[model samples]
Each structure stands twice: as C-alpha cells, then as structure tokens.
Target: MVTGPAPTAARRSVEEVRERVAAVPDPELPVIGLGDLGVVRSVATGADGVIEVEITPTYLGCPGMAAITSAVRDVLTACGHPDGRVRQVLSPPWTTDRITPEGRRTLLAHGIAPPVSPAPDGPVAVEVGGVPCPHCGSRATRPHSPFGPSRCQSMLWCTACREPFPHLTAL
Candidate 1:
C-alpha cells in the first residue's frame, strides 16, 4: 500500500490504461513485461468509471500472482485510477503458446531457453535428443531436473557449454 497524497485522476483512454498496465514487469521474470509474457488478458473501464485489468496466471497456483496483482494495483493508483482493480481470469488457462515472440527473445537473451510453442490442440512435444541451449544455441542440452524454481520452468544443462539454465516449459 503506497501511502502518499492521492494522485489526481486523469482522463485516459482505455488503450492508454492498457498500455500502462501492460508495461508492468513480471515480478519473477523482470526481463519480460506482463503483456509480452501474455498474462495481461485485457484492460477496460467499467461503466462505473473503475479501471479493470484482467490477467491469467501462467500456472494454477503460481506464487507470483500476489506480487503481480500488487504491482498492477500500485501502477493503477499511481496513475490516478484509484478505483482500478485486478481480476484473475482463469478460463482458457494460460499456455506457453501465449508467450509473445518478443518474450521468447527476451528470455533467451537472459539465458533462459523459451519453451517451444505447443500445437493448437495439444501440449508441446517432448524433445527427443535435447532442447536448445540459450548460452550456446546448441541442441545438446539435457534436462537437469524436471522441476525448476517455478512450475512453468525446468532446469537444463547444456552439454556444449556446460552451463545450466532454466527452460520455460510449455503448458
């Protein structure tokens, strides 16, 4: 809770509000914005003049949701939309495929191999040999562990570079 003088309300369009909210960074993965991460489902203004931001969680029990929600609320309040509220929309659950191309590039640049997008009707196919290594861009990476710091990621070790990195798993 930010405790300061209340910001003056400004008349911003829905798109403006959406852009401001979408620009918020993912708390866990600061390299990607919520929009690029595909968590920001929608932003709109209600008839009551309250701003509504809808987001989908990457996983059902993602630990970062609280932080994300807090960040959204803070941003809204700072921008003068004190009535703004965040809504968690779980329908049509989030999948790795929702990650934007820019998000993938950002992850790779940050030494995390982005998950291969899954098929429209199915989950991602398991890599037969190994997944690509973000460090060396080699396909000689093996899974160090199926579990990672987060539910949507796995630890991988690159044989080519002998480096360990996280891979965003396809949901």
Candidate 2:
C-alpha cells in the first residue's frame, strides 16, 4: 500500500482538509459520504498544525460511530495529515433535516426511502405516515416495523408496490 507523505511544517490548507474529510464515506452506508449524511459537522486546522474534525452521530449509542471515526482518521493519515483528530459533537444533536437533497436522492436510488420530516408544530412519532416507496415511488405505505436491521431505519411496506422497504427515521 502507498504511504502518506511525511509530516511537514505546513500541510494541506484547512479547506482542503475539510473537503477530504467530508468525502469520507459512511461505513454502514457506503453510497453516502459523511458530509452528505450530515454527520460531519466541521473541520479545521489549528495554528499548531493539527487538523480537527467534528462529527455528530445519527443518534446516541450508534454502533457505527467507531467505524466512522476510524474511517475519518484513515482518510487524514492517507492524505498526509497523521496528526488529525476526530471528535464527537453532540451539542446540536444531529437531525435528518441536515441530510442534503442529493443524499436523499442517493438513498432512494439504492432502495432505501429517504426520511420524511415530521410535523414542525409538535412532537411526532418516528414512523412518519405516507413514506414513499423507493421501489415503486408510491406513498401508500405502512410501517412494517419500528426498527429495521439497524437502529436508524424502520421497515415500511408499500401497498401500491406490495414491497417492503427501509425508511431512515427522522430524528
């Protein structure tokens, strides 16, 4: 395997570091980059020449955190920024609203229904009604289960397509 360049007094610019880290793919969802998934909150290079990356978990206790963190670090090292550090930022807990429109489209293309935002007025259940089916693009869907293979997703069944699909829950 090719190794990263040796550490130097000046490394890549802050923006470059940010862009590289942002492109890191989600371990669980390889099709979506961390930036598109809304997990990578920020990236900055300190005066001391250390690159710091902040990320938020899709939810607390997400098992994928370890893998995501590892991937970020790997990217930094591969890009010749071995001194980079990854931190978790929970202050402004992550929400599905942060997912970009492109990310949503990617999810649908890969057979997963993008999350549907809950009502803005008040608290809502995790399983939002009328979730469209990725397979058939029909809104006549019902909750198959509150939980899918992963904690971040819920199973949904489309009446129109008569197929089951996974819906990323809106948190």
Reference-based lDDT, each prediction: 0.87, 0.86
The residue-by-residue lDDT of candidate 2 on 1-82, one tens digit each, is 9899755544667787778777888877778889999999989876786888999999999899999999888878776787
TM-score against truth, every candidate: 0.87, 0.85
Off by over 4 Å in 1: 1-9, 119-128
Best by TM-score: 1
Clash pairs of candidate 1?
none
Q: Assess the local accuracy of residue 114 in candidate 2 as a C-alpha lDDT between 0 and 100.
A: 89
Q: Which candidate should be chosen as best, given lDDT against the real structure?
A: 1
Kindly list the per-residue Cα lDDT of model 1 for residues 1-171, writing each as its tens digit.
Answer: 769975587756778878887889987788889999999999988888788999999988889999999999887877778788899999999988888999999999998899886557876677666778988888988889998866778899999889999998887
Model 2 lDDT, full chain set: 0.86
Where does candidate 2 stray beyond 4 Å?
Answer: 1-10, 118-129
